[model samples]
Every structure is written in structure tokens, then in C-alpha cells.
Target chain A: MPYGYIASMKARPGHRDEVIDILTGGADGLRTAGCHLYVVAAATTDDVTIWVSEVWESKQHHDDSLKLPEARAAIAQAMPLLTGEFFTQETEVRGGLTGQP
Target chain B: MPYGYIASMKARPGHRDEVIDILTGGADGLRTAGCHLYVVAAATTDDVTIWVSEVWESKQHHDDSLKLPEARAAIAQAMPLLTGEFFTQETEVRGGLTGQP
Candidate 1:
């Protein structure tokens, strides 16, 4: 079973693109560690809001990903641009197109 | 290009499973209108939190799906169980496994 993570983040005014870029740049590296899906999207309704949906092979896989060098670096780079107002949801991915093999 | 929507919802007290059920029930109907993915996930960290990730062929495809009877019915059913603390992000889904042709 895959683990699903959905996080909502808000960037400081004018830093949305920067946050997205950092997220996008780190996405490929995440795939090396059983990250099945990592989709980052900018909100159409709110300029500073962004959403990230991820599917990892398992909970451990997701937990281990944060320890990766690229992941850590991306987080450090994205920290300043983030407003720190975020909510995270972790889910047991039942099934979906993104979770498919 | 496809439209991506990520929404975070909190269930009212203990209504998490019910909300997920309503969302899951509505997933198939959405596909009729070019909806590429509709993933309903239950948060692993928070029992009352649910996440929904959607991909549609286009923005119009997403909007039009809302006008469908099934979509409307699902929304109505799920509304009562929700805490109304949800945040939504609309994205221009550039590309992803789920959004693939």
C-alpha cells in the first residue's frame, strides 16, 4: 500500500514562484526513493497558495525521503519563501491513477 | 493541459470515514467528464483530516463536472460531514503520471 501526503502551503507575497521552483527542482530526486508521485501546483484562486500531493511506496519510504540530501536542501531553500501557515494530511492511498504502477 | 485541484478537508469530529465514502463514491462519475484522477485519501497523522487530489483534462472539464448531478449530490452529501476548514488549490497541472494520455 502506498502512502499519500497532501500539504497546503502559503508563500510570502512575491515568493510563490520561488517556492514552486524549489519544489519542482527537488521532485526528480524524490523519485529515486520510491516517490511515485509528487505534483506541485500553484493555486489559481490565491496567488500565494500552493498545493503538493504525493504518493510514496510506503510510510517509511516517505519518512526516509526527508533525510535525503536534496530533500533537506530543498526544504532549507523553501523555508524562507514559506509563510509557515501550512497543514499536512497523511493518507493511506487506496487507489488512484497516480498511485498506479 | 489539465487542471489540478488539491483540497484539504477536516471532518466534523468523527465523520472522517463518512466524508471519505462520499468522496470515493463520486470519483467514478467525475471520470465521465474527462476527469483524469480523483484521489481521496485519509490523513495518517490526523484521523479527521482528508485530502482530495483531482486532475481534469482542462479547467472547463473540472468546472463542468461540478454542474453534473453526481458531483452536486456528492458535494451536498459531504458538506454536512465537513468542518468547513478546507483550503483548495487550483493548478495548471503541467504533467504527471496521472495526467498522462
Candidate 2:
């Protein structure tokens, strides 16, 4: 089974720019960690909420990235700007039709 | 058929408390609007990314909450504390095992 993580975030209103800067950087960090199926989709509306979808080659690879400087830097930089509870989870993706027409 | 949304947000480091305040409020607002399968799971680590999992009775109902004071309030209050791009997506859940163990 493939391992993936889903996490949500909300940006401070006027500071949306700063938020995006770090988020883009965070994505860069994950890329170096070999994150696959990584999709960072910003919300369409003006709300601060965001969606982070990532599929890793394996759970071990995902866990290994925690030691990387890029990952740690993003976390350190992100500490002061969050306004609410940050959510994250690791799950096994199961089931879905893939029939091709 | 049902509708669900997944969004991600990251909190500024030291303000985790303030962030949780607004997030809990946001969840309250969502519940009033009749969200189903709403799971607001906080990340286990010090990193800020959050995961918001919500299932609506229907898409229309989910959209209806946009007008609620609580929803808007959460957004306004949450603006300055974020440090990264917020991601959101409407998706259809497909597949999984349901057999009794």
C-alpha cells in the first residue's frame, strides 16, 4: 500500500504573501525529500485554509525527511505565523476505479 | 454520492494557541451548517500544517456556509497568523475495504 499525508493550513489575511513564500519553499523542501504525488492546492476563496496532498515512495522515505535541513528550516520559519491548530494524518489509500474508456 | 473537502494550513510557531482558537471556531461554524464526517485532526509534531476533513450532506449545503458569520469571522481572525499557502479541494471519495473483520 502507498503512504500519503493530508494536511490543512490557514494563512493570516494580509500576510498571505509571506505565507505563500514559505509554503512554496516548503514544497521545495519536500521535493528534495523525494515526495511523490505532491499536490499543494490553494483554496479558491479568500479564506486562509489550504490543502496539502503528498504521496511518498514509502513511509520510510517520508519519515527520513524529518532530519533534512530544508524540512527543519521550513518548520522553524513557520512557527510564529500560525493562528490555529494544524492538522495532519498518514493513511493508506484504498479503492478507486481506474477503468479506461 | 456525497461531497467532501480537504484543506491544509500552517501556523506561525509560537502562536499555536491563537491558531487553535480560530480553528475550533471554524469547526463550530461548519457543524452548524450541517457538515458530516468532519474531522479536524491536529498535527502531532511541532510543524504547523493542519488537516481539515469534512463531508457535507451535499455540495449545496457546504457552499451555504460561506455566508455564515462564523465562517467569515474565522477567516478574518486567522489572516495575520499564517505563514504559508492554504490549500483546498473538493473531491469524491472512491474505494476502500468494508468487509467485517
Candidate 3:
């Protein structure tokens, strides 16, 4: 089964957009690293929270992606801008519509 | 901007599959109702929680879908199997990969 998670993180008060940019900027590397889906979104009712929903070819793929140079760099850059508050729900992707966004 | 949310609902014990069936069964109509993506997932570490991640052309499209006959039927059928526990996070989709799942 495909591995996935929907997670949220809070950015330092004025850094949400910068954090979002850093997160979304690594999409190309993620795709080549075996990602099936990677969506970055903003919490509609808040200014500092961001949500990311991702699906990977496998759990191992997801783990490995985090170790990739681009991925690590992105995370490092965003960490300082974040507040360390996070929420995550790991999931097994059963089925769904893809490619329409 | 595209509208989306990642929401989770808990099923009654031993009824997760039934609830999943009911939820995924409505995909066809949801697509016709202007859904861009509709993913039904199972929580990796739990048996009763089901996660649904969706993106619609507009919030109105999502609202209209819940009023569709099929949608209502599905909801009615699944409610009895649910625990009433739910979590929802509304989002404004920024950018990411789609259609690869």
C-alpha cells in the first residue's frame, strides 16, 4: 500500500509564506524520489499554519526522501522559521482521484 | 483558489471497512460534482479512523455534493457505523503534484 500522511506545522508569526515556499520548492526532487502526491496548503482560517498532504510510493521512499540533499536543505531552512508545533496523521492510501489539480 | 480539506472520521469497532466502502462508493458522483481529488485513506496505526483528503474546484462544489442524493444516501448508510468522532482542517491549496496516485 502507498504510504501517506497529512501534517500541519506552524510558522513563526510572519514567516508562513516563506515556509510554504521552502516546502513547495522541493517538489521536483520529491517526484523523482518516488512521491505520488505532495500538496502544500495553507490553513484557511489561520495565518501561521500550513498543511501538507503527501503520498509516497512506499514508507521507505518517504524516509529516504528526508535524507536527500534538497530535502534536508529545505527542512533546515524552514526549521528556524517554524514554531515546532505540528500535527501528523499517518495513513495508508487506499484509493482516490489523482492528476486533476 | 482551489478548496480542500483533510478530514477524519472514526468508525464503530469492526465497521471500518463498511464505512470505507460507503465513502469510496460515492466517488463517481463526486467527480461529476466538480471534485478535483477525493482520497479515502485508513489511519496506519488505528483500525477505526478513516481519513479523507479532498480538493474541489470551489467550496460551493463541495457544498453542493453533500446535498446530492447519492451523497446523502452514503452518509446515512455510514452514520450508523461511525463513532461521531471527527477532525477537519480546511485549506487553500497552494501547489503540488496531482494525478500520479
Candidate 4:
């Protein structure tokens, strides 16, 4: 099944832009690595909260992506900008731009 | 530009599946109406929280979609299952399977 995931991150005060850049900057690479959708969105009502919505070819594709060198590097850079609070959702993508439709 | 949005909803206790169904059941019609991606994801750690990640042809497409009869009906069906607390993110979807890639 396709892997659908949403990860909510809180950036430290004044670090929202930096975190968004980090997330978007890595998008091309993630796409090349099998992510069908990699959206980086900032919450409209909360300046410090950013949401990442992703659709991967499979659960393994997503899990394996975190171990990629580029991903590891990006995470290291983004970690400092975050406040360490995150809300994650992992769902079996039933359809839509996930190529499941 | 493509319209990307994420709306987080809290389903009343034991109503998560119902919300997910209401969200997913509307997918086919929405897709036919210009929604490129409409993913229904339930939070892994929070059983009552559901996240909808959407990509529409444009912001107008998304806004207009809410006025569709099918969408209107779905909202009416879902409102009672929700807690009225929602977090929304509206972003300029730069690229991805949103077809902007």
C-alpha cells in the first residue's frame, strides 16, 4: 500500500523560515528518492508550526528515506531550529495523487 | 499556482473511523471536480485526530469545491462528528505530485 504521512513540527520562535527552507530545499532530492508528494506548509494560524504531508511509494520507501545521507544531513540541520515537539500521522494511502487512484 | 492545504480535525471519541469514511467517501467526486490530491490520514498517536492533505488545481478550485453540493453534504455529515477545533494550513504549493513538478 502507498504510505501517507503527515508530520507537524514546531519551530523555535523566529526559526520558522529557516525550518521551512530546510524542508523545501530537500524536496527535489526526496522526490527523486521515491516520494510522490512532499509538501511543506506553514500553519495559517500558528507562525511556528509547519506541516509536512508526504506520499511515498510504500512504507519502506519512506522509512528508507530517513536513512539516506542527504536526509540525515537535512535532519541534522533542521533539528536545531525545532522545539522538539512533533505530531505524526501514518496512514495507508487509499487513493489520490499517491498513484493509488 | 496549485493550492495545497492541510486541515486537522478532531473526531469525537469513537468517531475517527466515521470521519475518515466521510472524508474518503467523497474522494471520487472531488477528484472529478479538480482536486488533485485529497488524502485522509488519521494521527498515529492520537486516535481522534484526522488530517486532510489536499492539492487542488488552484486556490479558486479549492474554494469553489467547498460550495459543491457533494462537498456541502459531506460537511453537514461530518460537522457533528468533529469537535469544531481545526488547524488549517494554506500554502502556495511550489511543487510535487501536485503536478507542479
Cα lDDT tens digits, model 3, B46-81, are 899999989889899999989988988989999999
Better structure of 2 and 4 per lDDT: 4
Best-to-worst ranking by TM-score: 3, 1, 4, 2
Model 4 agreement with the true structure over A1-101: per-residue lDDT tens digits: 66788888899999998888877876777776778777777666667888788888888899999999988998999999999999887876654443224
Docking class of 4: acceptable
- Alpha-carbon TM-score of each model against the true structure: 0.77, 0.46, 0.96, 0.76
Query: What residue pairs clash in candidate 1, if any at all?
Result: A90-B43, A90-B44
List model 2 lDDT by residue over B1-101, tens digit each. Answer: 44667766777877655765676655544655666444444454445665555555677888887678877777788878887678767854321211111
Evaluate model 1: give its TM-score.
Answer: 0.77
Among incorrect, acceptable, medium and high, the docking class of model 1 is acceptable
iRMSD, all candidates: 3.3, 11.9, 1.2, 3.6
**For candidate 3, lDDT tens digit of each residue in A23-91?**
988786677889988888899998999999898899999999899988889999999999999989889
**Ranking of candidates on lDDT, top first:** 3, 4, 1, 2
Q: Residues B1-101, candidate 4, lDDT per residue (tens digit)?
A: 66779888899999988888888887877876678778777666777888788877888889899999988998999999999999887865544343334
Backbone clashes for every candidate come to 2, 36, 3, 0
**How much is B47 displaced in model 1, in angstroms?**
3.8
Q: Judged by lDDT against the true structure, how good is candidate 4?
A: 0.79
